[model samples]
Target: MSENNKIAKELVEAVGGKENIASVAHCATRLRIMVVDKDKIDQPKVESVDKVKGAFYNSGQYQVIFGTGTVNRIYEEVTKLGLESSTKDELKKEAGKSGNWFQRAIRTFGDVFVPIIPALVATGLFMGVRGLVMQEQILGLFGLSPADISDNFLLFTEILTDTAFIFLPALVAWSTFRVFGGNPIIGLVLGLMLVSPALPNAWAVAGGDVTPIMFMGFIPVVGYQGSVLPAFIAGIVGAKLEKWIRKRVPEALDLILTPFLTLLIMSTLALFVIGPIFHSLEEVILNVTVSVLSWPLGLSGLLIGALNQVIVVTGVHHVFNLLEIQLLERFGNNPYNAIITCSVAAQGGAALAVGLKTKSKKLKALALPSSFSAFLGITEPAIFGVNLRYMKPFIMGLIGGGAGGFLASIFGLKASGMAITVIPGTLLFLNGQILLYILVNLVAIAVAFVLTWMFGYSDKQLEQTNEA
Candidate 1:
């Protein structure tokens, strides 16, 4: 038998046979299973299975980490064992059952933001490359002046860098519509209308280069380029309106009228009503975030860095995307990314300490990769699979993150963009502050490592260390 098949068989037995599983699915690094009876599973045996880095029950599913490529193979084999499988949508429905209203709202925020993150990340990387090529030191090495770069080439680069944020409303609206069970195409149309060329550009209007259109001789309207709240509010209104219309319209006219009316009404509302109110609200949020960042003594940084990971654990952290986007739009830089990167790195450091100190083979296997994942700016593995399980390591990470963030704020560290961190994040700081970025990360890691090694793990837990 193939190794994957062999492991699949063992895993099924470990979870008390195929009958115990209601459904199963896999994401990039984990197999998520919803079991019919938790009592039937042998948790120790599951951890001991080969190729399993770690396993934990969270959000109502048993998530078993098998790394990137390995998860697909294991998932294929598990399905062949006659265990029922679920689509991602089905899995989401099952997982959604566990959280409270607040928790569910947070998960929904995560759902909306996560889909759009890849576009943002790619754009950030593109900006990094542009910044790198524009550097005077690099250009001088090639005997080139800043003017040596052609205007056409610069314009092309700007297009690549600007496309994502320029149409961010469409992406946000599409994702939100999907979440709220509306036709995503209609959502896209409504979003596009919010930024139509007929309206003055949001930035142009703000810069006084163009005047805003007066609506009903009282309200002002402009394009929602780089705006967050308008698209989000429009999406919810559109989706709920679409659902309501679908219920009342005849089945024969449902497809045409529902979509047409939804788009028509939503576009009008978004441009005149929802857009103005939420744009003002978004501005308020942006100002509040800036004021907090500017607070005395790095106090804001210390507080945000300590509490950020805790928010991440609750999955509500994606809401900060609004603030980050606004910060980048107004000031052309983001200190928030720098502050949060410290917190993410601290979690990795704490996990690494646990890996080094633990005698349990199962735990060591879990901690090492979880730590590496955390450093790469994905902390769910480290947070849920290792640090939180050991309680003390999680707290140590919080302390270390706060210290690192305080220093970062004091040094005035800032990033050119959002959504990338630690190693991949180095690209964002290549504008002459790379050394400071490295130092901040090192401080976070070292502090967390020392704290975890000193007080995070217990000798008693070590004494109880058998492989499983």
Candidate 2:
């Protein structure tokens, strides 16, 4: 079995076994389960698992946090163990997530990228503002060159981003244990121990050097500072271990003894095994990014442009921010982000078209504002309220976006700086003919507007909606 599969099986048993669960599903960073008996669900028992975030019984759902990359693995493991079944009730829960394949695809993509967005955005704006400051010499930003100011900031930003990911296991443990419906305070304590520097340095052990914290080595001291994999794995281990430790210890001394042993064992496993394996996977992903973008620019841009629009809508769009700003800062002109510019045009055009076709004073008011908002790059209001609700407008917008992004890629278009207007979208496109690129963007939007009007304006639905 895959290691994740083994961990899931153990977790399933720990949480009062598989039969106790009614249903389960996962989104980006959490494993959501519905159990038949809440009483059988032991909060402290679940928190004991090193890989879990604490559990919570909110909205009648048991939510478990497993950090970023680990959720999928857990989902795969959960399915293999038969916790999630194909049934109507389950499908209904998914309805709110997304319905059509296109929408679901968008949601799935967003699920992967959303949680990391704040970190990504903070890092990008940090670099951008840092760049502007040095160029203007406002703060007299010190660096080897004007560009160096931004580069230096990114170097520091990387530390923050990398650190969060590095001890990802700890994050998962902390979150899972808290959400597990236990004493959340204890779960948070478990999380802290996984990330604490007091743990033995696993890196030293891997490198064949004796750990300075020799006592911790024999005992499994996990160091999760800015780490991802170890803490997560440890959490899974910790969860099961929690159950075993609970029955033996009396209620009076349970708090101190439970966490102390849980950390001692789980952290060791994290340092020696979980952290190392996940760290390797991260290296592989970085290498792939380097290899993929190294190919011809035109093809790269087109692919990125197409995928970018498809993924951005689901809110996972934040993941691409790294590909655009961070990748370009280092590798130059990240073509992957080029596709998003076309998406903005497509949605804005569709919204405008929807507005023009509607005569209902109320609908017209909604659609017109939606169009303007879409133009400003907030397309969800337009997508969910205006386009996807009807059907044709959404398809038309996607087609328009695809075509526009494809063309932008072919022309070697590049975006230079972040700007608000549609005209400036082309500024990033290095197409020697900047004005031509802007015109093309306008045309793409117009086409979307026309297509949406042709397909989406149904007399019956409009009349019905108007009546209501």
Give the per-residue lDDT of model 1 (tens digit) for 102-207. Answer: 8777777778888888887777777777888899999999999798999999999989888888898998899899888898988888888877888899999999
CA-lDDT, candidates in order: 0.87, 0.57
Candidate 2 at 386: error in angstroms?
A: 1.9
Clashes of each: 0, 49
Candidate 2's displacement at residue 295, Å, is 6.0
Give all TM-scores, in the order shown.
0.92, 0.52
- Candidate 1, residue 452: CA error in Å? 1.7
Our model 1 lands, by Cα RMSD against the true structure, at 2.3
Candidate 1 clashes between residue pairs 3 or more apart in a chain or in different chains: none
Scored by TM-score, the top model is: 1
Q: Model 1 misses residue 342 by how many Å?
A: 1.2
**Model 1 CA deviation exceeding 4 Å by range:** 1-19, 37-48, 359-362, 465-468
Q: Would you give me the overall lDDT of model 1?
A: 0.87
lDDT of 2 by residue, 62-98 (tens): 6665655777788778888877653433632444343
